[model samples]
Structures are given as structure tokens and as C-alpha cells.
Target chain A: MKIICNGTEYEVGQGTTLLHFLAQLQLDPDTVVVECDTEIIRREAYEGTLLAPGQNLELIRFVGGG
Target chain B: MRIMVHEQEREVAAGTPLSEIAASFPGSDLFIVNGCQVSGAYQPREGDGCWCLRKGEMIQEHELRRLLSLRHTPGVQEVISRAVVGIMGLGGLGSAVAGALARIGTGRLILADYDIVDPTNLNRQHFFVDQIGMKKTEALAANLRRMNPYVDLTLHDCRLTAANIPLLFAGADVLVECFDDPVLKAASFRLALTDMKTMGYVGASGMAGFGDNNLITTVAHRPSVFIVGDGESEAKPGQGLMAPRVGIAAHHQANQVLRILLARAGMLMGL
Candidate 1:
């Protein structure tokens, strides 16, 4: 299935979970906020939140210092 | 013949001038009576409803900054003066942002920080040597009060979580994300998008290390979420966090905060 992450498109397995997809991109699940189709995916549900085709996700991570 | 000013009835002679009363309140030249801007010389008639700008209690320093702010942005200082902004951290970003906001005549602030001033924070954070052992919110509050005694402040010396985010910042117009941890920042952002939907949020990210200054800018990813500073300058071993870079990012956050505050009320004219 194809999904848009931060304006870029990518293809992943059909049943890939947000947790797995984030891990594949080297993004730490504990350190990033994920919004799928404009809905926030809580950390506990990341493993069950399946990414559908054409789903748009915004990933934001905080940096160190102020 | 009863005339109201800020809900207070002032006993004056029938022919007493408005300018006389306006002069009593520093920075209060323009006043509205019954929805119309009246001249200072205009005398109030019976049953007049009036509101005076900059009528709040102010000290000398508060009046000075209020004058400068009103001069720089006409009709804006009052709105900002009545607003309450939440500062989530008391380190580099929160402390600097607090000072800037207070100096600009922000009437009230809701500050929450559990950390204490440490020697390491001396490098980039806003703290004096005497405040090394004091709580972040406590020390910053003292400094702010000294700078502007009239500036109201509410301090929350505890860790902020999603459960308490709504309650803690219920009255704040905008929440500034200045946390240094990635997980906490992300968690706060989550709460900002959900619990605090009506409130505007300005967050900091990628403001680490002594990287390119030009790369640092505010990105409005969402209508309510604006991230300041470059999104790549994470503090690593090679590139350490310098005071200049931290100050730059912190100022960017402050600028965004002012814009959001003004824009929220539709008072931001080309600023």
C-alpha cells in the first residue's frame, strides 16, 4: 500500500502498522508524534493502527535543548 | 448622572473634562464612551458607558514598557497586555520568552516548570548566579516582577502531562512548548491538538547545536501548531549548543508567540 509521509509518498506492506512503518524509517516511535489522515495515533494504538493506501501522515519529533 | 469607567463610577463635577480623568491613567489618551472614541475634552453626560485603555494598575517600569509597546503598535499593546500566555519550560526558551513577553506588556503569564536553575543552564538559559538553586518558575517570577510589577503571573511548579494540560492551561490564550525532551514535547503537542484545540501553540524543534543560523525559522505545519528553529540542528557531540544559537531559536519562538497572540485577536497588522 502507498502512503504519504510529510508530503512524500512511499509504499509499504498492505498490513503494515504505524509502529512498523515508523521503525522502518528510522523514526523512534517514543520520540515522534504521528497523525494519520489528520487523526492522532496514540502510542498504545500504534501497533494496531493500520496504514491504508493513500493515507497521509505527519511525523513531528522534538529536538534537544530549548 | 452616573458614568461608568471600567465598571467603576467616578464622582465628578457636572462639567468636569474627560482628559482630566484620562490623564490619571498613564497611557490612556484614547477612550471609548458608548462605543465611540471621544476626545479627551469631551465631558461625560448622564448614564454614559465608558472604557479606558491602559487603565490597569501599573508601576513606573510597567508604564515605560507600556508606552514603548503602544508606540510601536498602536491599539495592540492593550490586547497583549490583557492576554495570558503559558510557558511550559523555564530553561533557555521559556525564560527568554517570558522576559520578552513581560517586557512587551503582556498582562499575565501562566508558567509551569519543575526544574531548578543549574550551573549547566548558565551557558544558555536565562538565569543569574544567585538563582542557581531556585526553582525555574520561582526565580523567573522574581525577575519578572522586578522588571514589571504590574505583570500578573501564575506559577505551576510541577510536571505537565496530557491529563492535566487542559486544566493547567485552561485560561491561557497560547501555550509555548519549550521542553528539552523529545517525548515530553511530542506528548504536549498531542495535548495541544486535542485537549487545547481552541488555544494556539508555538513549539520549538531542531534548535540544537551551533548550526547555520539562516536555517532557523518558524514553520506553521498546522494552523494551531507552529515549530520554530531549524528542524535538523540536534545537539550532538561535534556541534554543542551555544548561547547565540539558543537565544536565536528562543527569540524566534517569542516572535511567533507575539504574532499568534495578535493574530488571534485580528490585531496583527502586517506584523
Candidate 2:
């Protein structure tokens, strides 16, 4: 299925959880806020939330530097 | 058609651009339309209102609060005065954000930072030479007091860990993450967003170096979560953080803070 992450389209396998998605992208769950289709997904729910086709995800990464 | 310019309503052509209206009233330092900054080329629709702020105006201290209230959209300053904003870092972005909030009469601020003012921070951080060696919380609090003595401040001079983040900023209406360390920055923001779900989050990333001011911007990851910065620049060996770029991001964070507060108060319905 294709899902949009941070404005970019990506194809992931079926039933791909947000946690696995982050691991594939090398993004630590503790570092990024994931918004799926305009709703912020709770950090604890990352494992249960499945990425659906055409889902618009906004992943805001907190790097550094003031 | 009629549009508001400050306290008075002015008759203007149906599609008169904001630039022409602004030009009619000379010496205005800042222009705000419908509670947000708009380009001068913007064409104001009927019923759209604006405030054209002028600099160097003298007013008594007792009148300061009243004047500030009058300058903004009606009842907006009241919303600002009831907000409690938390700042997690006291570096360039944090300091400028704090200063802007203080100047605008934010009700309270919760400041947390472990570092002290160092000589290298002079290029971007909001500290004077005399403040060197002083804890950032103390130095920033002192400076903020000068801007608005009435604004309440709570200082936590210790480093805010993921464990202490929730407790330190329990009453904050919003939290701004402005850490300089990548690991700590990511950790703090994650903690705030997950642990403090009630408070809005404004985190900055990739605000470094100079040139291309437009690259720095504000993005809403969620309705209550905002991130401001270029999303790519980093303070590396050759490219260091400068005041201009850092200040721009800081102001964006500060503005987002106000917008969130006002939106929560039912003032800015557009947000």
C-alpha cells in the first residue's frame, strides 16, 4: 500500500504498523511526532496504528540547535 | 466597502490592497490583518480589519496594559494575558521567544535550562557581557522582568529530563522545545507530546546558518503541535547559528504560542 509520510509518498507492505514503519525509516519512536490523517497518534499507540493506503502522515522530527 | 484600521473604520475601494491602506497611515511599524501578519500586496476583503502599530510611542507604565489591549484585535490581549507558556531551552531560539512573549504581556512563563551564559553565546543567545557565568534561567528572568515586570516567571535551573518534564511545566498552556543538543531535543519533545497532551507543543529543528530567511517556516504537525524551522539546516563545524536566522525561528515559535493560546480561548477561530 502507498502512504504519504511527511509529504512524500512511500509504499509499505500490508498491515505495516507505525512502529515498524519508523524502524524501516530509522526514526526512533521517541524522537518524532506522527500525525496520521490530521490526528496525532499517541506514542503508546504506534504499535497498534496501521498505515492505510493514501493515509497522509506528518512526521515532525525534533533534531537540535536553538 | 469598510475596513478597520486600528480603532477607526475607513472607507476603501472594494479590492484596495493592504499596501495602499498602510501607506495612507504613515509611520506604522507593524501591520496585522485579522490577527495575523499579511503581505502589503494582500487585498483585504470587506469586513477584514487590521492594526497598524507605530513605534516610539510614549505611554505611562500604568497605561501600558491598556495600550497593549487596544493595539490587538479586541479581546485578544486578554487571551494572551491568561496564557502560561513553557520554554525548555535558554539559547538563541528560546531567549528570543521568551523576550517576544514577555513584551506582548503573556501572563506567565515557565523557564528551564541547566546551562550558564558563556562567551560563545554572545553571537545569538540573549545575554549581556555582565550576564556571563550566570545561569540562563536567572539571566533570562532578569531580562524578562525589565520588559514586563508584571509578567509572572517560574525558573527551573536544572536540566529537564524526560522524567521531570511533565512536573516542571504542569501549568503551561503550551511548551516550546528549543534544545541545542539533538538527542536531548528529540527526547524532550517526545516527552512533552506524549506526557503532556494537554499542552500545545512548539518544537524547532534545523534553524542554523544564514541566508535564505524564507526557508525558515512554521508547520503544524497537528492542530496543537507546531514545528518551526528550515527542517534541514544544522549547526555544524563551518556553519554556526547566527542571530538573524535564529531570531526569525524564535519569533515564529513565539507567534505560534500566542496563536494556540488565542485559539484555545475561542478568540482566533481561524486557527
Candidate 3:
């Protein structure tokens, strides 16, 4: 299954959760806030929510400023 | 005797004795001693062969110590040190926030408060009984300097006023809104938002009351901000700020600052 994340495409296996993919990419969970499609995934829900194929994901990390 | 100092492919001649050779290159901190990896220390032998001192190579002990002391990430340190961070109200939340940033090597800190350290503050403010009569900023800066001699700290021994808000945060990189008063908190938010365009600053609110561990949440993004200690959450009207809860929130705030700075430098992984 193909999913787009941060403008990059990945061929993921079926029933892959966003959290699982993030872990596979070695992304730091503490640094990033993940949004699946248009909805923001609460930190508590990252572990449980599975990603559907062709999903558009946005992963934004915190940077310096106010 | 002539020694060779290599920087990339460029090699320059260094005088006899390692000390003399090292003195010649004023800006180069990295060095190589003999054939082994050494930094900051090099003693020349009587029968000296061509000793090579190269940038990015190991150095003798003396030089090594100096190099180690010099912050390699100068740009990051400069930004942190020169940047002013306003922490409102030096109570439990303010105390923790001030100390954490000072200890972590923030160059300059602006601590604002109008309270005296009360006897009760000892419970969580990390202050001694002798500090009760002293102003919060004075005591806090004293403690902060003791924690990190490198930090430059300033104190505003007064309340946050609308008139002084601009002066208080003139060059501040970020404003940490730890005031317990809801009115002041709202005021600070307004001040930050209005000046953010001019000062390039942002703020975090919501650290008050108790159950600190539960109150804390890590919020990241460009100009990362956090609201710690459930200030927005319900708490008893008369209940004062607890140490553990306020301390946890303060820690979260400090960590977010450091993480934001690191992220900006592209040095941190896992925002």
C-alpha cells in the first residue's frame, strides 16, 4: 500500500498504523506531531489507529520560536 | 626546527617544540600529536622529527581542555546566551523554570517577579530558610548562578505591568508565561502575540495548581511552545501551587526550550 507522508511516498504493508511506520522510519515520537489525513491523532491514539492505503499524512516537528 | 600543520590539503610550517608550534596557529583548536591521537597537549622531543599538527586531528592535553571548554556550537550558544527569556512570577513554576534554563547553559536570562520568598515557598522553591525575606528574583538568580557560572542572569524585581511589558521583553527570544494570575496570563499572551512579529517570540501558558505530572504535555513545532501544570484545568480556588506539580511543568518548559534551540540548529533528532 502506498501512503504519502511529509510529501514523500512509501509502499507500506497492509494494516500498518501511523505509529508503526514512524517507528520503522526511526523518527522520534517526542519531536513530531502526526496528523493522519485531516484529523490530528492524539498521542494516546497513535498506537491504536491503523493507516489505510492511499492516506495522506502530515508530520510536523517543533522548531525554535515562541 | 620546522613542524607541519595541515588543514585539509593545506600545510603550514610550525616552529620547533610543540608549544611553539601550537602557539603559531591561534584559531585551530584541533591538533594531532606524534602518530597517536592526542589533543590539547604536546611536548617536543630534543631530537624532533617533522611533527604534524592538523586541524580535525587529536591534540595534547592543555589544548584539549581549552577546546573542550569552547562550545563547538557557537551559533547555538550565542543564540541561547544572548537571547532573553522572560519568566513571569517567581513562585513554584517560575523558580523551576529559571533554575532549569540557567543550569542548561542559557547565556542570559531575565527573571521577573514581585514576590518575596515566603516560608511556604521552601516546600518547593528549593530555597533555604534564610532566603524567606529576600526578593524572588534575587534569590533565584543567586541560586541560578551557583548552578551555572556561565549563565548571565538579570532580575526584574517587580510585577509585570502593561507599561513595562515592552521593556521587559524587548529582545526576548521567547516568553515563558508562568504567572499564576489568570489576568496576568491573559495579558502576557496578548503582549507576546503583539510583539511576536517584532521580537520573533512565542510563549507557553497553563502551568499552575497541582497534579503536575498529569498537567504536563510536550508540544513541538516551529517556535515550539507548551502549557504546563494544567493551569487551564480546574483546581481548588485557595489551593496553592505544589512543588512537585510546578516543578514538573517547569521542567517541561525548559526541555521544550532546549529542544527548540537544538531543532533550529538541526542538531536534534526526534523533535
Query: Where is the poorest 10-residue window by lDDT in model 1 chain B?
Result: B62-71
Alpha-carbon error at B224 in model 1, in Å? 3.5
**Candidates sorted by lDDT, best first:** 2, 1, 3
Residues B156-235 of candidate 3: C-alpha lDDT, one tens digit per residue? 88888656878876776666766655545544544443344343333444444554366467553234444444434433
Residues B33-57 of candidate 1 have per-residue lDDT tens digits of 7656678888988766665675454
The TM-score obtained for chain B of candidate 2 when compared with the true chain B: 0.77
Q: Return the TM-score for chain B, candidate 3.
A: 0.65
Give the better candidate number (1 or 2) by lDDT: 2
Estimate candidate 1's RMSD in Å. 7.3
In order, the first chain's TM-score in every candidate is 0.92, 0.92, 0.84
Specify the highest-DockQ model's number: 1
Error of 2 at B129 (Å): 0.7
**Error in Å for residue B42 of model 1:** 29
Task: Give the DockQ of candidate 2.
Answer: 0.36
Deviation in angstroms for A57 in model 1?
Answer: 1.8
Estimated TM-score for each candidate: 0.79, 0.72, 0.55
Each candidate: RMSD: 7.3, 8.6, 13.9
Interface RMSD of each: 1.2, 2.4, 11.3
lDDT top scorer: 2
- Model-by-model lDDT, in order? 0.81, 0.84, 0.61
